[model samples]
Target chain A: ELKVEQNPLFLSMQEGKNYTIYCNYSTTSDRLYWYRQDPGKSLESLFVLLSNGAVKQEGRLMASLDTKARLSTLHITAAVHDLSATYFCAVVNNNDMRFGAGTRLTVKP
Target chain B: EAGVAQSPRYKIIEKRQSVAFWCNPISGHATLYWYQQILGQGPKLLIQFQNNGVVDDSQLPKDRFSAERLKGVDSTLKIQPAKLEDSAVYLCASSLDWGLTVGELFFGEGSRLTVL
Candidate 1:
């Protein structure tokens, strides 16, 4: 079974601060994805890291994948109130896709 | 292009009652997925279909849950004799190709189920 673990499940950060949400999985796979969901809304795809050392960024968020370590990270730079939402990382292994427990972020001004 | 569409955004039912949710995937999408998301957790894949054929359904609770995709276009998920633990959001997703290699998924606003 593939297991995904995310750190800092609930985060409260000041606006303009920087933080990283970590996703660790127990499988060897090259495909990983990041998604964001607002309260009572559907998931919005953020980034798809397909290779080791692959990094993708959009706005204040950057995501990277390290396949050898079975780890991925979503970095938030200079967060804003609008970035407050739940973020999730999903990994695909052997045709099975597993998602980590989401990281809920709250930005305060 | 239209995104994945789901009906009955919210549903409230008594335990042991039956309920069904519907989904219409993006046009030309060959892969469809159904996920169950509980509060404070990530979405869990319950079943996946590839062009009207089931690809995976290992995680679905077979005794009380059933799903089908007809004509490789629309899908429906039905739950019979629901329990309180079954109260969660049911999400529908679709992709252009085989899901394993393509990680990008278009998701619908999930149907929230509440069992009383």
Candidate 2:
């Protein structure tokens, strides 16, 4: 079974600051995914890290994976109020995908 | 191209009542998944289907929850005699390939269920 864990289940950051959310998996996984969910909305795909050292960025968000460490990071660069949302990281081992507890982010001005 | 579509955006019912949610995946997608997301938690996969066939249903509560995707394009999930613990958002997602594929899974807006 693949168990996914994320650090700092709740985050509160000021606008224009930066932070990173970490995701660690218990087993070896081939794929890592990042998603964002707004209040009362469905989840939206952010990034897909398929290999070690893979980094993807979109707007103020960047995600990277380290397969050897079984870790992935979603970094927020100079965050803004629009970036406030719950972030979830999921890992796929074999054919099963397991998600973390999610990190809820609140950006205050 | 239309994304995943779901119906009954919100439902409020008392304990022991029944509720059903529906989902229609994107065209040509072969994989469909149903997930339950409780407040302040991540989405939990309840069932996954690969073109009308059950691929994984280990986490589903068969005692009270049931789901079906007969034609491989749309699906329905039903909960009978619901409990307070069952109050959550039911999300539907679809992918173009199987679970092992490395791609984004399009998701629906989800149906929120409130059990009193």
Candidate 3:
């Protein structure tokens, strides 16, 4: 079975601070994804990292994948209150994708 | 382009009652997926389909949860004799089957269920 584990299951950060959320998987996989979900809302795609050393960034969020190590990371630069949400990292195993338990983030002013 | 569409945004029912959710994928997407998400947890895949054909359903509880995609476009998920633990959001997503981008999915708003 493929399991994805995320560190810092809950995080509270001050505005303008920086943090990184780590996602580690048990199996080898080349495709990983980052998604964000707000209270009572469906998930929104953040980034899709398809290869080793793949890195993608948008606004204050940057995601990278290291396929060999079976790990991925979502880094938030200068966090903002609006950035508060639950973040999840998923790995594609065959035709199925398994997601981490998720990291709940709260950005305080 | 319009994103994936789902209906009955919210539903509340008593245990042992049945419920159903529907979804329509984005125009031209060839793959569809259904997932169950509990509060404060990540979405869990229940089933996956590639153009009306079942591709994988390893995690689905075949006893009560059932889903089908008709005509390779619209899909429906049904849970019979629902249990209290079945309370969760049912999310539908679709992906463009262009070989290179097999895993990038477009998601719908999701249907939230409350089993009382």
Candidate 4:
């Protein structure tokens, strides 16, 4: 079984602050994905990290993967109120993908 | 392009009742997946289908939950004798098969079920 663990499941940060959410998996994976979801909404893809040392950034959000360590991170730079939502990191191995518990971020303005 | 489509945005029923949800994947997508997401948790894969054939259903609760994709296009999920723990969001996603590569999945708004 593949297990994914996320740290600091609930985070409340002030606007303009920086924070990082960590995702660690128990087994080796070929790809990792970051997704965001607002209350009552479906997931929105944030980034797809396919290789070790892979990093992708968009606006205030950035994601990176380290396959050797079986870890991934989602970093929020200068967070804004609109970025408040639940973030999830999913690890994919072969044909299966397992998701982390998720990090609920609340950006207070 | 339009994303995956799901119907009955919300459903409320008593325990032991039966309910069904529908989904329509993106045009030309050959793979579809159903997931269960409880409140405050990440989505858990229930079943997956590739062009009308089930590819994986190991996590599905076979005794009460069933799903099928017909003609490789639309899909439906049915749950009978629902339990309170089954109250959650049912999400539908679709992706293009690229043989061995993990493709990005497009998700629907999801159907929220509440069992009282």
Best by TM-score: 1
Tell me the TM-score of each prediction against the true structure.
0.98, 0.97, 0.96, 0.98
Q: Whose lDDT is higher: candidate 2's or candidate 4's?
A: 2
Instruction: List, for all models, the DockQ compared with the true complex.
Output: 0.84, 0.80, 0.66, 0.73
Better of 2 and 3 by lDDT: 2
The full ranking of all candidates by DockQ, starting with the best, is 1, 2, 4, 3
Q: Better model by lDDT, 1 or 3? A: 1
| Candidate 2 per-residue lDDT over residues B3-34, each given as its tens digit | 99998999999999999999999999999999
Please provide, for model 1 over A12-102, each residue's C-alpha lDDT reduced to its tens digit, 9 standing for 90 to 100: 9999999999999997985999999999999999998999999999999999999989999999999999999999999888778899999
Q: List candidate 4 segments past 4 Å from native.
A: B98-102
Clashes of 4: 0
In candidate 1 the C-alpha lDDT for residue B17 amounts to 99
lDDT (10s digit) by residue, model 3, range A1-109:
8899998899999999999999999988758989998888878999988889999999999999888888899999999999999999988876558889999999999
lDDT, model 3, position B69: 92
The better-scoring model by TM-score among 3 and 4 is 4
Pick the lDDT winner.
1
Candidate 3 residue pairs in clash (backbone atoms < 3 Å): none
- RMSD versus native structure for model 4: 1.0
Runs of candidate 1 with Cα error greater than 4 angstroms are: none
